[model samples]
Target: MKPTQRLISTLAVVATLGVGLTACGPEDDPYGDGAGSGSGGSSASAQPSKKPAPSDKATDRADGPGDCGTPPKLPAGHKMVEPAVPPSKGSLSAKDAKPVCTPNDWIYHGQGKAKYYLFAQDVKAELSTGPGRTKSVPVGQLWVHAGDCMTNPGAVKAPYTCSGNIYDITLDSEGQINSIKEIWHP
Candidate 1:
């Protein structure tokens, strides 16, 4: 055959093979399981699986805050005054506490005392409403030191000092304070 004719034939054959391969569907693909008929063979498998919601109860333990250890003893001369709102549960496990968008919402929503109590000299101070700076605690936990409590009503600024006891708290999905544990106290 002439060289030009041979080259033309080869080119035609390659084009036909390319089109044939391109036409193959998932059903025709030997590597595919056929579950995603129209989608590319591996693309269907590459899609990410749906992640479970953070608030799903099934992911957490059945027990509530009753399972947490005993809370720290109230400071001497410090009385356990009733909080404006009490926490929903006495305690909660780290797994049960859900990440919340607004930590204050969780802090103010529960049935338990709305604020933590601290005693200085003979006087008692409210942890929530008291004067101090407020900052983000670690994940799964919220903290408010007696010094961290705000005395002023406006924006929280620096010069924070550790005052009374440190109130470490946690919350559930519904923004309820599920657990309260005191870390440090005078």
Candidate 2:
């Protein structure tokens, strides 16, 4: 093969690898067994995680705020929407009358087996919201325009890092994460 051809081929391979690796940042902890905060991390996995105990305090408030009695009034006429509580796939269950909001530091296990896994801050954390910069623009509310899913966390840019950020996850009937909203706290 010509030298130019070989050089171009090498560049193409490097570019491809760069993109794949950049998706999940090297510094980003991406693997965990549904337990402690930022315990372990790696790339997205295909298998299900071993169920943890049902008494995890971090995941105690599996449902979102105002779940039991009054639901929080979502701005832009967005009300808390989700399916009725279904039997949990793992230790987490959506046991509520309204939508299922799992409040914990769940790592978003990337899409797999046609299901999105939200383990205890250890699967692969995928924010329905796209990327954004960090700046105190408004209150806890995430400023999202119409036809937009959501913006990245105020402090952190990447969503898969999943370490200290707390989130309210909406699970479907089959116990799969549908949408995720990161809660800002002081």
lDDT of 2 by residue, 1-186 (tens): 699999999999999999887745312324312333321221110112333333432242354321111112333422122212221333322222132222222222212122224334222222323223132222112223101222333444433332223334555555555444433222
Tens digits of per-residue lDDT, candidate 1, 68-124, equal 111123333322221232222232222212211120111111223234332222211
Q: After superposition, how far is residue 184 of candidate 2 from its true place, in Å?
A: 0.1
Model 2 earns a TM-score of 0.19
Residue 71 accuracy (lDDT) in model 1: 18
- Worst lDDT 10-window in candidate 2: 39-48
The candidate scoring highest on lDDT is 2
Candidates in order have lDDT scores of 0.30, 0.32
Q: Where in model 2 is the C-alpha error above 4 Å?
A: 1-164
